[model samples]
Target chain A: MMAAEKDEQILAMIKSGGNPERGYRMLMDAYQLPLYRHIRRMVQSHEDADDVLQNTFLKVFRNIANFEERSSLYTWIFKIASNEAFTFIKKNNRHAAFFDKGENADELESRSVSTSQLNGEQIREMLHVAMEYLPVRQKQVFSLRYFEEMDYRQMSAVLETSEGALKASFHHAVKKIEDFIKSKNLY
Target chain B: MEDLRDELKNIGSRLDPAGKNESWDIPEGYFGEMQNMVLVQLHESKSNRPNVNLRNLRSGLYAVSGIAAMLILAFGIWFFAERSHSIDPAGIQELDQDQVYAYLEENIDEISLDMLMTDKQMESEILFDQPQSEEDWDVLLEDVDLHDLNNIF
Candidate 1:
């Protein structure tokens, strides 16, 4: 179905008195993975991602009654997901941890979570670890552009950043990840 | 995952964009379970809204304030106890000192052991329980105006 038709159906089911829970379930089904991936990348913990995603949906459900049609449903939902991740990261002190690390451990060892380590791991795993070194905003820009393949316009709507700034952040994120991986000898 | 070697080499050159890999750690079926957990949480918060909302807070405040106000008023009355308007000063002046001495000597043993009562207790007893009423002596002492001290007779 087209985006507008799907949104219409979802909204109708949710607004109907018959079974609104079913509509909520459908909404979850459609947006859960996209939101989860974004959250997991930002938090670097499966448990934290689960928390953030649940909060995102809870916020969505609580605010759905006031959803205006100014933005597409997809954009609105993504915006919520993005905001939740940022808030979760800040609340959990993930940003503080990254800043305190001073960015200098070539053989970073994290037994619980290989957040920025590349000790004999594959290039893919190293790539995952390297992305962890980015600032929260840059990491998000990179995740959306590289993995989610969101265009500049979609990213701008969700991140509420200008297209030029987002492109610059993404560029800086790519360079940082590449440098981190190579300098750590994770070739 | 696309190789970043090309991108690394091109960082100083053409600056080709790098690749992405999504092998993050997660529990099995986390997304499915997360949805159910969220729904359960929503249902729980909704059902508990009665106890969590502002209406309950307002009601609880009123009940607490009522009890506190009653206690403060009762304490204030007790703390500021004054001579009653009904006390007959002339009646007390009419008793002879010899008659009072004789009465005290005869009833000293049953006079509430006033020696053992604290000064405050003795004062309170003398202030409130000195009068005779139209009932059994003990009944008048224990009951009468004290029945629902809440009415503050």
Candidate 2:
């Protein structure tokens, strides 16, 4: 079935108070990979990503009843995942004192090689390193807009902020990253 | 705006399929495990509601027991007071002085050997017995010395 048709069927079953298991399973199957990657990028650690991914779905299960049909299920799920990611970041920022020993250039270099076709691995590493320097909100906005390809309207819904503000955050994020790259002569 | 959009697109392309082919695959059976965990929690919540109800019932029983104990205590006191009144109604009545003396006189035979011995014994008896009259008491008081009255009256 088309994704929309499937979503409608799931909603109907959920509303009827029928077993939510099948519906929840369907949602997990459909969105797990994308959601995992999104969290992985946000947290920057595989174990943390795995932990948050499970928490995200657990939240989806518990709160699915409260999901008003005002927005698409896709947007609702993404919003939940994003909130979890931001919560993780806030918790970790207190320990930023421990994490601030300059970026692991070697680790970034290794990871960037996979995407070396478009930009050299070093440049990509430079970009990622610059990303780590951004304020939490800016990094989130930048990742959602650029990597996730979420538009301002969608991002507004996920971030629960105005579209204008999201755009401004993205703008500032891009400027900072570009300046960092140029100053370091990374490209 | 177009330039910025292109730059963002370029960034997006670079970050695409992030961590692809890395060993960061989602653990096996993760979704199933999550579903099971949630189901277990939901079931626990369902059972927990009854435990709360039972706690409320226990407290209610305690309250009823306390009230019953108080009622029993109150009834015990009332029962004892009522039984005492039923057994001794005349004892509860007020008595005049003459009535008190009459009662004592009526019981005099039982109270002493002198009263039991009779008139012959009374003629030989030397123990003083006063008459129950105010005039005799005053005459007796006049014959006695003031010091003797102080000692004997």
Candidates in order, TM-scores: namely 0.59, 0.57
Candidate 1 lDDT by residue in tens digits, A1-187:
8867888788888877478799898889888878888888788767778888899999898788788867888888988988999998788677523324323223432431344443233455556566667778888887787777777798899999999998778778777776765565544
In order of listing, the candidates' clash counts read: 0, 0
Global CA lDDT of candidate 2, please? 0.69
List where candidate 2 sits over 4 angstroms from the true fold.
A94-106, A109-126, B1-153
lDDT of each: 0.72, 0.69
Which candidate gets the maximum lDDT versus the true structure?
1
Cα lDDT tens digits for candidate 1, B33-82: 88898889988988987656788889999999999999999988865554
Docking class of 2: incorrect
Error of 2 at A128 (Å): 3.5
